[model samples]
Target: MMLRGALVPGMIALPALAAAFWAYAGEHAALSALAGAATVFVILVVGLLGITAVVLGPAATSMAGAGVVYLGQLILIVTVVLVLRGVDWLDGRAFALSAIAQTLLMQVGQVVGYVRARHEIHPGSLDRGAAS
Candidate 1:
């Protein structure tokens, strides 16, 4: 559980760092696109976390923490997107497609990670414990 908790932040940090790098490089257009995409990603992650929290109750600590991080990221992304849109750097279609694609990719990543983590934590415990 501790290891999983540690890894959750690391998982989020990758995309956050990438977005920050793009923003820092003065690639305003690219940064805006990335920010828009990140917003969608964060929304999807938060939705997933909410579902997990409902199902798992108090055991959903990691998911809840991840959701909070995603929320913060979402706010940053939305602010960047709005700023870019106001400045005329982001086109409608490009912005929309970027957000859609990022959401899909983030969902896939989350599902895969969840499955992999479950397997790691459970291993053969279910079968072995059942036999005992």
Candidate 2:
């Protein structure tokens, strides 16, 4: 459910960014960007999936469950960074930049999803009717 909103922007961005990097840098940078973006997309989806249960559960448990899921997500990212650091072929700068871009795009998607969700739960039409 959450993955729908979170993944859209990243998927839309990947091809354009990869093509741009290919034009300016080379095959290596382009592949690096693709790899980085893919890695982030997988991680984000996993994180969102992990939180789905928490988000659907009792309100009181939501915050604590989210906290744990996020902590694990951070650790997973750090591990990926460390493991990738030893690679010789990957362009570090391109990889890092692509990851950052993907992360930002996902954040934007999350915000949009939140707003959409809020309206669905308590739309203005309902409020106006209540006020009548």
Candidate 3:
């Protein structure tokens, strides 16, 4: 589910951001932006979804273990971002813009996905009992 939600936003943001960067900047910038966006998206989805699986699976039997997993994922993400920042091939402006855009879009997609899911599971005031 997390992957599904993230995929929608990633698909929406990547091409749009790539096109914008290409028009305003150049091929390198566009490519860098797309790469950065993809990296961020993968990090987010994998970290969250992976932890979710662990939590739901037999590996994480307690909330404390889940918390530890979450912390580990955060550290891994930060490490990746820091490493990416030092890379010579990265375009700082495009990378920053793409990261921000993709993150925001992911948040929006998650909210929409949650609402749609909630409505599907149980029709409330917002859903109005409408058919999914």
The candidate maximizing lDDT is: 2
- What is candidate 3's TM-score against the reference? 0.71
Off by over 4 Å in 2: 120-132
My TM-score estimates for the predictions, one after another, are: 0.44, 0.85, 0.71
Q: Considering lDDT, which of the candidate structures 1 and 2 is the better prediction for this target?
A: 2
lDDT (tens digit, per residue) of candidate 2 on 1-132 = 347778889898788778878998999999888878888888888888889878899999999999999998888888888899899979988888888899889978977786566544565875785589
Each candidate's lDDT (Cα)? 0.57, 0.84, 0.76
What TM-score would you give candidate 2 relative to the actual structure? 0.85
* Among all candidates shown, the one with the greatest TM-score: 2
- Candidate 1 wrong stretches, greater than 4 Å: 1-28, 57-87, 119-132
lDDT tens digits by residue: candidate 3, 54-92: 767775475776677768756875776788888887898
> Candidate 1: lDDT over CA atoms?
0.57
The backbone clash count of each candidate, in order, is 0, 0, 0
Q: After superposition, how far is residue 97 of candidate 1 from its true place, in Å?
A: 2.5
Point out where model 3 deviates above 4 Å: 54-70, 119-132
Report the C-alpha lDDT of model 1 over 1-132, residue by residue, as the tens digit: 323432354356446644654565545545555656656655555555555555566664766665676676567656756766676655544455556556555656665576556643577885685599
